[model samples]
Target: MKAVGFHEHGPLDNYDLLDVPTPEVGDGEVLVDVKASALNYMDLFAVRELDNYVPQYPFWGGGDVAGVVTECGDDVTAWAEGDRVVAVPFLSCGDCRFCVRGQEMLCEDFTMMGEMRRGGHAEYVAMPEENLIPIPDDADFVTAAAVPVAGGTAWRALVPRAKVQSTEDVLIVGATGGVGTYAVQICKNVLNVDTLYATTSSQEKAEFLRDLGADHVIDYTEERFDEAIWKLTDKQGVDVCYNNVGGDTWVQSMRTLRWGGRLVTSGATVGPNPETEIRQIFMRQLDIVGSSGANSYELAELYDYVWSGDVEPVIDDTFPIEEYMTAFERMDNRGLYGKIVLTQE
Candidate 1:
């Protein structure tokens, strides 16, 4: 099987496309013939972060996969050969307290598929039967692949974690990427927010966000979005602020939220250790909620949204599986307005 992986953690250059041994399907697992895989910021992060990601050397990292089941394990009964599926790539010990309560993302033993082991940036992947979600038979693999991590993150952040109300006004910082675009869609199309605001680096991306249902688009390159949002709201902040770009934007993101409004986040792609203004959180009586991968139930919900056309994955581009390195390079530049998918030829 052809896969992309790194034998050691270092630069993006370390990621090599090679023909490695195909993964074996153990009991309770299924081997998927990966039709498509979506790239996320975490895929690139795992390439550089040496401390707390990946279980071993020669690790491959891709969390979003959509494909057909080619083989099933002896203990697997829920899925079989030729089942069309999308993977819930984050894994947790099912016996844990959190897992039993359906809060698997909070399990102490929680680990991501790509981060913990080899992932779907390959021709084939073997995952536990329980980790797969069934998509509609007609669902295209590229779009389904785009939904798992990016769409799932946005859904988990906005719907379950934040519990955003329909009438609320929203500001989504860095709303051009996969999660951002989905957040915009959910805020507008699903939640029906009174006002939906988003930030991007350029007017082109701002227009793209507008088409995705953002009511107001702020070009961060030309203006400070926090100030712009405050002015737009007439000095009153928004009811909610969703931020995944965590750097200097942390302070501004908090400022854009109304008193007692929530600030939800799933990632800090900008930089994790952000300079803080604790006062914005405490003095303002703001609620800061953190979210991670989509739980199985949430992924299922996202599939329904995509299947029903209530929301759609924003696919920026597609590349052949052999061009994984090229896709990673494009992602590293942060030039895309949505996800870049890798498809099997």
Candidate 2:
């Protein structure tokens, strides 16, 4: 099997395709012939081994994948060979306390694909049968591959983490990236949020956000988006603010929220250590919630929306497995409107 990996995590220069042994299926696991996989900021961080986080050398590093099952291990009755599927990125011990309560994302053994274990960056990968979610026959493999991490994550942040309400006015920061595109659609089509505000760096990206159902798209590059959002809501800020871009934006993101409003976060792409305004947080009775990627239950529900076309995956570009370096380059430099996918064929 050919896979995109690093001999030892260091920098982008260390990443490339290497001839590696295909993963074998284990009991309750399935061997998948990977068709397409999506890249994320986590890929860049993984390749760089930021803070010495890579668990081992020659690490496989892809999270979002859509593929066909070529073989199924014993005890796997729900899936079989030739089944088109997408797996939840996070692997958790199913018997744990959190898993029993349907909060597998909080499991003590929680680990993401491409981080602590072999991921779907290759022609073949193996995953637990429980993690597999069926992809509709008509769905594009590349698009389906883009869902597990980005879309599932958006579902987690909105439905469980933030508990976003239908009557709430929501604001999504970085509203043109992979998660942002899905976030906008989830808010509009699924959550029934009528007034959606988004922030993007370019006018073109802003237009894309509008097409995704953002009611107001502010150009963050030109002005402070908090002020724009403040005025857009007639002095009453949004009921919920979804912020993943950490940095200076953290403190400002709170200003976009109304009194007692909630701010939900998933990732910190810009930088993690953002100075907080504790006084404003206390005075406004704000809730700052941190959420990780979705659990299997959330992924299942999210995929229902995907199959229904309510939540769609937006692909920025597709690169062959061998050309993953180019894909990584695109992800490193911002400005993409959606996901960057890698194809095995």
Candidate 3:
């Protein structure tokens, strides 16, 4: 099987395209003939071995996969050959307390598929049967592959973790990035929020964010985004703020939240260190919620939304599987509006 992998943690150029032996299905697993895979920012982070979450050498990096099942193991009865599916990226121990409660993302043994183990950046991948979700016959592999990680994470952050409601005002920081693009669409179309504010460093992205359903787009390069939000909201802050960009924008996100408002975060792209305003938390009774990947139930909900056209994944570009390095370079430069997909040929 041909796959893209890295023997050492470093730059994107360190990735190598080589032929390795195909993976085998275990008793409770299924072998998938990967049609397409999507890249997440975590893929870049994993390549660099940042934040102590290091993968062993020869690590394959990709998280979102959509493909057809080629073979099923003895214990895998729910699916069979030729079944089209998308795998949920969150891998968890079924016996864990969090997993038992349908919160698999919070399980003590929780890990991402591409980050902790061999992922779908290959011709074939063997995954546990439990992680596979059926994809509609009408959906293409590229669209299906775009759903698992970015869409799932957005669903978890805005819908469940933050509980964004129809009439509430929401602010999505970094609204043009992979997760941010999904968040913008889902918040507007799925949740039907009253007002949506999106912040971006680029004017070109500000226009794109508006097309993605952001009611107000602020160019963070021109002015302080918090002040813009305050002005737009008439001195009142947003009901909720999505803080995916941690260090670079966390303080501004904190300032943009109304009293008693919630700030939900999933990733720390700018580095996690943020000045803590202890008084703001206590005096305003604000809620700061940290979220990870979505659970099975949330992923299922996200799938339904995608199928129904309530939310759609934006693809900046698609590359052949062997061009993994080029894909990573595009991602590292922030040169995309949404998820970058790699297709198996």
Candidate 4:
């Protein structure tokens, strides 16, 4: 199998396209012939080994996978050969307390695929049967590959974790990124927010966000988005803020919310430590909630929405395995409006 990986974590230049041994299915596992895979910002962190997250030597990381089952291991009765599926990124011990309660993302022994072991960046991958979800027959590999992490995370943050109401006003920070695009769609089309606002870097990106259902777009590069939101809402502020970017944006996102409003976060690509405004938080009775990946039930809901066309994955570009470097570069530069997919041709 031709795999894209790094021998030791260092930098993007360390990644190489190597001919590696194909993974074999184990007991209760399934061997998937990877048709398409999608990249996330975590892939960049995994490659650099940030925050002491060390992968096994010769590591490959790709979170979202859409493929076909080529073989099933012993005791894997739920799936068989020739089944089309999407692999859930988070893997949990099914016996854990959180998993038993259907909160698998909070399991004590939870870990994500592509972070701890070989991932779908290769031609084939062997994952536990429990990690596979049968996608709709009409779903294409590229679209299915885009949902597991990006769409699932957004769904978890906005729908279940935040419990956003249709009458509420919402703001999506970094609204043109992978998770942000889905956040906009869910807020506008599914959750049906009263008003949807999003922040991006450029006018072009702002326009892209508008098309994704943002009622208002603010170019953060030009002005402070919190002030923009305040002005737009006539100083009432939004009822909910979906904030994934951390650092300075954390304080800003909180400031954009109205009294009793909630802020939910999943990713922290833009530096985690932020000088929080405790005075404003207490005075306004704000709620700050941290979320991670979605559980099996949440992923099922997201898949159904996608299959019904109520939600769609935005693809910025697609590349073959050989051009993986270009795909990484595009994501690293923040030049894309949606997910970047890689095919295993």
Candidate 5:
């Protein structure tokens, strides 16, 4: 099997294409012929072994995959060969307390597919049958690959954790990236939020966010986003703040929230820091909620929206499987609007 992976931690240039043995199916597993895979910032972080996190040598790196099942282990009954499928990226121990309560994202043994184990960056992958979700026959593999991680994650963070309601004002930070783009659309279209504020670093992205349903777009490079958000909301502050960016933005996000409002966070791409103000928390009585990746049920609901054309996956670029370096370059340069796909061909 042909695959792209890295043997040592460094940069995207360290990745290489090579011939590796195909993974074998285990009991309750399904073997998929990977057609497409999507890239995320986590992929780059894993490759560099940043934050003392180390992936196995020659590590395969892709979590979101859409492919056709070629084989299924004996114990698997939910799906069979030749079925098209998308999968939930998180792998958790079923017996854990969190798993039993349907909060698998909180499991002590929780690990992402591409981060902690072999992922779908190759021609084939053998995953637990429980992770597989069938994709409609008409769905494009590239688009399907784009959904599992980013789209599903946005759905869980904004819709469920934040509990965004109709006619409420919402502010989304980093509104042009994969998760941010999904957040902007879902809040505007699905939740029917009255006013949507989004932040972007560039004028083009600000315009793009407006097209995606943001009622107000702030160019952070040109002005302070918190001040702009306050002005947009008439000094009352937004009802909810969807923040994935960390560092300074995290602290500002709390300030942007109205009294008794919620701040939902998924990832901190800007790196972590201790910047939260205790005064704001106690004075405003704000809710600080943390969210991770989505579960199978959330993935199913997100897929339904995708299938119905209510939400669309944004594809920045597509690279052949062997061109992992190029894909990572695009990701590192922040030159993409959404996902960078690697096609198995």
Candidate 6:
């Protein structure tokens, strides 16, 4: 099988196709013919910073995948061959206390596909039956692939982590990436947020955010987002701030929140550690909450929205598996407003 992986990774320039043996189907697992996969910032880290993360050579890294089952394990009854499915990215040890309670994201042994294990950036990838969810026949593979990671993650950030209220005004710092696009949509379409403010460096993305239901879009390149938010809210600050950009924007994100507002975070795409005034948290009574991978509950609800078209995937571009470097280049340089999908064919 030809996969978009590398024997060894030093940088994105070093990653290319690898002639790897096909993965075998295990009990309760299914072999999927990958149709489409989506790119994320983590892909940049996987190929560059995550040294020795894979157990072997020829590792293909991808977390968001949509495909069709070509073969199913003998014990698998819930799914069969030719079933259209989307991979739920995260794998958890089912016996853990968190997993038993359905909070698998908190599992002690939680790992993400393509980051800690073999991912679906290949022609064929094997997934556990439980981690695969059926998609309707009419659902586009590229769009479905874009949904699993971004949609569920954005839902986790806004819905559960931030506990966003429908009547509260919210802000999404860095609203142009894969998760940010979905976060804006989920805030409006799913959560019915009263008002939405999102930050982006480009005016193109700022307009995109507005069209996607953000009440206000802040172009942070021209002015600081914290100042913009302060002015926009008349110094009242927003009720919630969905901040994944970390370090560079952490203090500003905290400053944009209202007194008693919540700041929910998942990733620090920018530098992870940044200095901040500790007084802000104590003085304003802010809630700084951190969340990780999306569990089954969030994934299921997010997929339902995807199936219904209430929350749609924002596909900026699609590249063949062979051209993943180009797709990733667009993501790494912040040249995309939404997911850039990779076609396995």
- Write the residue-wise lDDT of candidate 1 on 190-269 in tens digits: 88999999999998888888888888999989999999988999999999899998999998898898889899988999
Tens digits of per-residue lDDT, candidate 3, 49-148, equal 6435544657786789999999999888999899999988889898988778877787898788888877889899998998999999998999999988
Which segments of model 2 are wrong by more than 4 Å?
A: none
Determine which window of 10 residues in candidate 5 has minimal summed lDDT: 49-58
lDDT of 2 by residue, 1-345 (tens): 898888876789898788999888899999999999999999888877453656766887889888999999999998989999997889999789988887788897888898778789999989999888888888879978998888888899999889998889999999898889989999999999869999999888888888889899999999999999888889999999999889999988999999999999998999889998998799999999999898888888988888888888889999988888888999899978889999976
Q: Supply candidate 3's per-residue lDDT for 301.
A: 88
The residue ranges of model 1 lying beyond 4 angstroms of the native Cα positions read: none
* Superior by lDDT: candidate 2 or candidate 6: 2
Backbone clash numbers for all candidates listed = 0, 0, 0, 0, 0, 0
Q: Which 10 successive residues of model 2 have the least lDDT summed?
A: 48-57
Q: What is the C-alpha lDDT of each candidate?
A: 0.89, 0.89, 0.88, 0.89, 0.87, 0.87
Model 6 lDDT tens row, 1-345: 988887766878878888889999999999999999998887888878887677666677889999999998879988978889999998998999988987888889888898999898888888888898888988889988998777788888788778888899999988888889899999999999988999998887787889999999989889999999999899999999998788879999999998998989888888888888899999999998988768766898888988898999999999998887788888888778789999965
Judged by whole-model lDDT over C-alpha atoms, candidate 3 comes out at: 0.88
- Model 5 lDDT tens row, 1-345: 977787888767778886899999999999999999999888888877653544456787789988999999988999988999987888889889989988888898888888888788889999999998988878889999999889988999987788899979999999889999899879977888988999999988888888888988999889988888788778999999999878788888888989999989898887767478988988999999888899888888888888998888888899998778888888899867988999986
Model 4 agreement with the true structure over 238-274: per-residue lDDT tens digits: 9999988888898899999999999888988888788
Return the number of clashes found in candidate 6: 0
Model 2, TM vs. native? 0.97
TM-score between model 4 and native: 0.97
Clash pairs for candidate 1: none
Cα deviation of 267 in candidate 3 (Å)?
0.4
- List runs of model 4 lying over 4 Å from the truth: none
